[model samples]
Target: MRIVGDGTRALNFFIDTLLVFLLAYAGFKTWNFYVMYWGYPAYNFGWFFFGILFVYYTFFELVFGRTPAKWFTYSKVVTAKGSRPALWQILVRSLVRLTIVDMFFIPFFGKPLHDKLSGTVLIEI
Candidate 1:
């Protein structure tokens, strides 16, 4: 997690997904642990789950340039050089997190590349 915005990553590594995962887990529990026994079907629901997260973060980040979580943590998502990121940039970053990057090699590669490609960084504000 010691990437460019390492602090932000460290603090939010699990926080961002807490609600999503808890809800997914609770749903599995209510369904008689079917998902768990079935290898946690929610685990494979990449598109649906990440899509929801993307929409949430993208809309908010585009409008506010910072999600509530980032703001609460004294951070803001912005271009690497500290400019406000456009909607597409935010979407790119979120998509990278949702797909190729996070799904495969977390704390591995995508985080920094996302910052670079999206021209964004989660800065400590």
Candidate 2:
């Protein structure tokens, strides 16, 4: 498998971020409906959005070894030995993604903090 470049990584980030936003919007709508139905006060979804972001990556990567963005980019996450990463690695990756500026590390650090901390790499299929 070939390691992807920054361009592919950027594409993946864009697509994934879009998807996450859409998901959060849908979730907010549904939640608002239920809250109104129960006559409860409206609430902000900032924390909920973060939760969705974490779950999105964790669920997709844990189950399929990639996110929808990764699938579209023809890439998958793998360990240093070129195998599927373990559950712990996927979780670590997802958690690190919530840091908000982890992507900034790519230029100077080569890989993002998520990839380094998780011991995972994105490889082209």
Candidate 3:
């Protein structure tokens, strides 16, 4: 399997981020609607977006070994040996993503912090 380049990785990130934002926004609006209906003040749930983001990556990666964005990019996550990663590896990957260090590491290090920590890599299908 060929390793994907930065361009494909960027596209995957953009699409996945968009999907996560949409999910968070939809859920936040639904909650706000109920709060308004109950005569309660609407409050910002900005922080919860990160929680949604975490779950989005974890659930998708665990279940399919890739996100929908990966499907579009024709790439999937695999270990160094080109096998599907373990559950702990996938969990570590999803969690480290929230730290946002991957953005800085990718250009210089040739891989993101999540991939490095999780022992995983994105490979072209």
Candidate 4:
């Protein structure tokens, strides 16, 4: 196994972000349709989007150790010793994904801040 390169990791992030955006868009449109039909005020989608993303990442990582993007990229999350990360580690990794700085550091440092904080790394399979 090898640690995935920065470029591959960035691409994975882009793909995941796109997926999340698509899901959020669908949710927003559905909610708006219902709101209009019921004559209720339109609700902001930002929180809903974030909540979906949080659950999406956390759930997938905990169960699969990777997201769809990672699967497509042939990469997966693992502990420092190269074993599957524990549930708590997966949770930490997922939660830290919400921090913008974690992703921003990836281009410059090769690894994201969340990986360090969670004691996990992205490995090419």
* Cα-based TM-score, every candidate: 0.64, 0.93, 0.91, 0.89
Query: All candidates' lDDT scores?
Result: 0.64, 0.91, 0.89, 0.85
lDDT of 3 by residue, 1-125 (tens): 89999999899999999999999899888888888788766767765578898899989988998999999999999999999889999989988989956778887779999998888989999
* Candidate 4 lDDT tens digits, 40-101: 67879886677778888888888898999999999999899999899888878877877777
What ranges in model 4 sit over 4 Å off? 39-41, 107-110
Candidate that would win on TM-score: 2
Q: What is the lDDT of candidate 4?
A: 0.85
Off by over 4 Å in 1: 1-5, 22-47, 100-111
Which runs of model 3 end up more than 4 angstroms from their true locations?
Answer: 39-43
Query: Model 1: per-residue lDDT, tens digit, 1-125?
Result: 11235566756656667755655555445555665565554444444456567776777788988666676677777776678887688878877766554444435655555666677666666
CA lDDT, candidate 3, residue 10? 90
lDDT of 2 by residue, 43-106 (tens): 7888668889999999999999988999999999999899999999999999999997898888
Query: What C-alpha root-mean-square deviation, in Å, does candidate 4 show against the real structure?
Result: 1.8
Those runs of model 2 whose alpha carbons end farther than 4 Å from true positions after fitting are: none
**Worst lDDT window (10 residues) for model 4?**
102-111
Model 3 pairs whose backbones collide: none
lDDT for residue 55 in candidate 3, whole number 0-100: 92
